[model samples]
Target: MGTVWPDVRLSDSGDEAPTSPQRSHLIGGHDSKSYLAICSESAVNWLKARVSSADEQSVTDIVTRLSRHADYKSTFMCPPKLKQFPEPDMQMAWKYCQEYFDNRVETLFGAIDRRQFEARLRAHLQDGDNSDSDPSWYALRNTIYATGTRLLLTRTGCDAKTIHESAMQYFLNALSVHTQVLFARQVDLTGVQALTIMSFFAENLLGSSIESMLCSNAIRVAQGLRLNYEPVSNERLSPSDRFVGNRIWWALYCYDKHISLRDGRQSCIDDDDISCALPERQASENPNKFEIFMQMIKSAQIQSLIYKKLFSAAGRRQNTIQERAAVEQLDQALSEWRDSLPLHLRPGAPIKKSSLPAGVHIDPVVYMHYTYYGTVIAMYNKFPWTARGSSLDNAAFGREKAVSAARSVVLATRYIDTDMNTTGCLLFSYPMTALIVLFVHILQNPLAPSAHSDVVLMDMATGHFAQLEFATSMQLEVQFVRDMAHIARRAVEQIRRDAWIDVTPFEAPEPAIFSPTMTGPNLNFMDFLTDDVYAV
Candidate 1:
């Protein structure tokens, strides 16, 4: 078992409590010590009231029961509670948390009012003198700290085992916080935001089924707050506030679709009932970030349609012409969307073709295009590729379109050095999908022009994923990426074997020989990792 560090354990970590007041703002406080110093008299009163008022007795009762458990052992560590810190460490951790939380906009959580959130945190922090007391507020504070610190560390390339394990301790404690009081009422939007951030982390970490459940909880909370419906102007919310609400709603929508599409399940929020508009662009948010977010939501919307129109019962009907027509419509729409992107947001021509170091900046726009391109590749996979067919034959169209789209994806991955791609597991499908398409088509035409180059490209893509598996914290995603690479490699060998067998007419035929349809293992890795609606 991996080492599990306590939340406030003594350690050799470089970051300790900061003493100088001048150096305070840079460290994320509260996130570390919950609140280092409650500057406001109101905050102090609030903490005092909470500490002296209620929940104290109940905490005592729970601790007593745990210690008296029939099978209790001193060797086992107990679940952590809110630990008080001296003025120094709490101040430091709180500062670090604030800094990290600000970065959450780009790294972990999406589309939050940072100024408002910072205010709420300051409002929550109070002047208190209880080192022995545990409060639910304190628990949530550490939760934020753990989440924020982990996001910061992961993004900054601090893959130290000790750091992650310590962060995990706080995270588990936060999740395991006494829910009896916390969830007694409708969870606030901030609470919902926390759940979403946790869910996102869980997905990156490959936390088995918890990622799905946490995301479900987030959707439920958001709906409870009626965030799914747009708030009218008469409600007195400023236009900016309303826009933030809409952004949060879309964020939930996107996350819901992402999780559901991955596992081939239905999304909780039906698009039919979502009347809220997209967030109005604002000066505060980075335009690039907003563009990427909008693009993902659109992609999620497309994914929903893809599931319903192509992979569901409606799509399974034996109506080829209509299906082709429907697919053609979607294909056209996707192309239009791609063409509509602003020039800078659109994928730029590659800068260089060499392996890039981890710190080298890679354009995120490439991944944006990669997402849509992967979708296009998957669209072609719905119908088997055939060189010979009738005028309206989907098989023939699928073959040519898939081959061309696959080539584009391959070229994109080939030129970009993925070692510098900071997203890690998020874009696992991009290169892997490119590799899959090339693998399938190469099997069919190994002697074709550019086939050898395609093999080298697949190797590069596979190696990129392989390096990511061990280097990144997203163990599960990297595992899946490597799994797809194995699948691609095997596919190549199988194609070669089938070539020999095709010459020996008595030998059995390869399933992938006619593998355009999603039968057998010729699955498109693009959709295979998350959405298997088309799985046979």
Candidate 2:
């Protein structure tokens, strides 16, 4: 059986009379202890202890419940064959394809070549039902349709429910051919791209674990094709084909690092194994076009290093001094990455609405900041606190960094348009983490000047989730966050009330000591006399 910490016992009556200020005979004045200072310290400590304990149990319960509902196996196994699915609406499909290329495609590290993909799509549509058609191509087309439909949810006249069903139908159509694409003897490049796209679609509907598995499978296939290495100039591949291959490989690399860090799992792609060069902008393209994508890839590299040098099991075994050094090194690297970005793309840089290109979506810009701030929070959120003399000061500095990052995440939400496509989990997870941090801050310092405003920001985040629920089938997760926000609000109110009350200081009763008898076969009575036994 697990042992529980003994509770701090209170007075038998459960209420004690407040003590009057003690007089000092030597100074002929009241004691040096300030009533308000003691009260504040006592309240903060009491709340911190209770909040820490409750957070642990709450997190465990929440994780267990979520795990039970997660569908890990379905993503790996072949999807059930559908007896009947809607015939392709060729015009609508083309429309979605165009929408994807025009707006969404720029945001991702490249996968499909626009001109080549369109020509093939035209031929595929013309060929209609030909036995020679590639199953992988069919899956890729459907995945694009699904992505496009979901992205245009707000622009359509149909009700959100209807639009959502249509999107899922396209996704299901793509998933139905999962086996053909995944189990092919000679893995096609299109198959790898399809799997990559499907994994992202799954992440919005399913969860990170399912997405991780699909991404791992995609990486495996890409590796099988040697996409991890740059193509030789002598190869028969065209310049465009080579560039597309490079883009796809880096896309997989960026995503592998992202999902691994997000899920606390090992990355599928190893930095040591990668020799692929970063994709460059074509001569015909605008010089600044791929800047954001390149920056994201760089950021992902930092994230990979962060997991390797800090969060990995081996890294966790490092001494406090070594850990601090690792953190500082990573922090410097991250700072350099941000600084290397263009002035307009920096984390807190202000964007002029008029300066954005025609039809350009701000989502990518918002995502850059989210990723940057999220990385900052991840670095410091779980930093260790030791018993050394400077530990308290170091902890305070770390906490400040984390809190500042959290605030930045919450503040960035204002830039997110209500009608914007936020079906991705990162869109929700970053703000959710920020909200929880603010919630805890209010609990720890209920009378803080920003406490009331923090509650407002939390409400904004909750409302953001409510909006996103209409775009994606994440009602359960959103509702869970809502319930948590409700509980946090109530806790703030109670803490604030208690803070103002003039109550007696809490004094814990003496703990009852326990002496255990040793009778086990391996027990040695002499062991008790060792210095280690009395160290406690």
Candidate 3:
């Protein structure tokens, strides 16, 4: 039998209670050790109030009640309730949130007037008593900044620059808090609250060249966890682990989403889209536009290398292709046998293919653009000179630089691949061939001089590399890819069944060859490969 890892026993074991101040924050002051549960309840109640409110008055009442509670005022909280609010009224909700915060007293709720709510919120946030209880508090402290950002997008209708400038400091603050939460040994309530904060941080900041910063932090945290045998405390580990893992997944997802939204070769926003400017852009594109582009490319290259490493590592841990195919065949045969049973003896008839779960609904244009960006970036940056770069060497000479780079790429690919295989276990098509096509095309016919400049090359290289990293990183995550594909296919089929675009479920398309009419912005990565005639 496989040995289950033993739960870490606390070396400094004690039933000792927290000090008086700490005890005050708990449900009852009976020598309590942690205020996490109360704080969570407070945050949930607070967020629920904010979301359930029909108008600002209701929110104000809720905030007042929250302020009176020790859990709300002294302890930290993160309200996931905000995620459920409808998009249409989110702006108004944000506005109501902000209207109370012209001063430092209250951002959420204080005994003070609406005019002083901001001051009180800031004051409470900055107060020594309520400060630093948990990372979620840090996120809460930054909500005003996010709220301000919402205003910049929806209310003020300002430029990306203005909104970005306004939100940077807060974004950094949240990130700093997130870093602490990720590595904290004694996971607590505040840590779970901080997860949303980290999620937003990854969402906005890790899109451009600075994505390396996010990935580096993630790897470091994971490594730290592996090395440090820490004892789990409270309910923090359960939720925090999920949050941190989910954040990592969403970080990669955001990279994919951003690439799709932005043009293939440029990181700058179109001066119009609300999402074009967030605090992350300011930090990412800091220094200058050229520097930003360079950093972006470098980061993309690093990401691709990591993805490759992870893919290779994962491949080793997972079942072989033959094994997977056999399993699939068995599943298919069993399914057929089940379908063949007599009507009375058969289990409740399975739903037709038409009734599968909803597929992810994504915009065709966005999906296509992102795929193109990733493909192009990978070819140019990840494997700058050649696709068959090596990962082994022992010399210190300049002649070894090429070998070193190759080795580094291989190393990164191995690490990332392991995670995909052991953890993600989802499969998706690789973007390698797509990248190869772009490189070949670029070599055969340089882009028009007018259209192609140093800037374009830099942008294209990074974008392609980003795509390559994502594709390669996820290639071994068989289960996730299958689920995603199944969802997408099912959703498409469902839509087709609607009177709008009537159709039947499609057969799996032929591999290595693509139908011309099926081509669009979001073609699967496999479709970009040249026919067998062009094989290397």
TM-score of each: 0.63, 0.75, 0.31
lDDT of 3: 0.29
What would the TM-score be for candidate 2 when compared with the true structure? 0.75
Best by TM-score: 2
lDDT digits (tens) for residues 1-536 of candidate 3: 00000111111122532223223334322111011221233333432332323332332232222212222212222332222111113344345346324422111111112333345454654543434456555554454455445344534555433444445545456655665677676644334333433333333321122332343344344333321123232133454343333333233333432332221222121112221111122232223222222232333333333233222244224444533343234334333432443331122221122222232111111122222223322222222222123221111121122222221221122112211111110011112222222222222222212112212322333343344234333221122112222222333333444535442223221111112221111123232232221222
- Clashes within 3 Å, all models in order: 15, 0, 45
Global lDDT scores for all candidate models: 0.48, 0.59, 0.29
Ranking by lDDT: 2, 1, 3
lDDT comparison, 1 vs 3, better candidate:
1
For every candidate structure, what is the RMSD over all alpha carbons to the true structure, in angstroms? Answer: 18.4, 18.0, 26.7
TM-score of 1: 0.63
- Using TM-score, rank the candidates from best to worst: 2, 1, 3
User: Candidate 1 residues 1-536, lDDT tens each?
Assistant: 00111221212223533223322312221111011112122322322232323433322222222112111122223535543333225564566567555544334224456667566556545454423133344444555666666656655776645445656656565465435214745345556666665555444332123555667877776776677676862154466656666776787787676545443456687778776667666665455566667777777788677656765666656376777787888877776676766554453233231332222223445555565655666566522232124344436556555555555555455334332123322334345445556654554444444445556666666666555444533332233333333444444445447576423322223223224532111324353234322222
Error of 3 at 497 (Å): 52
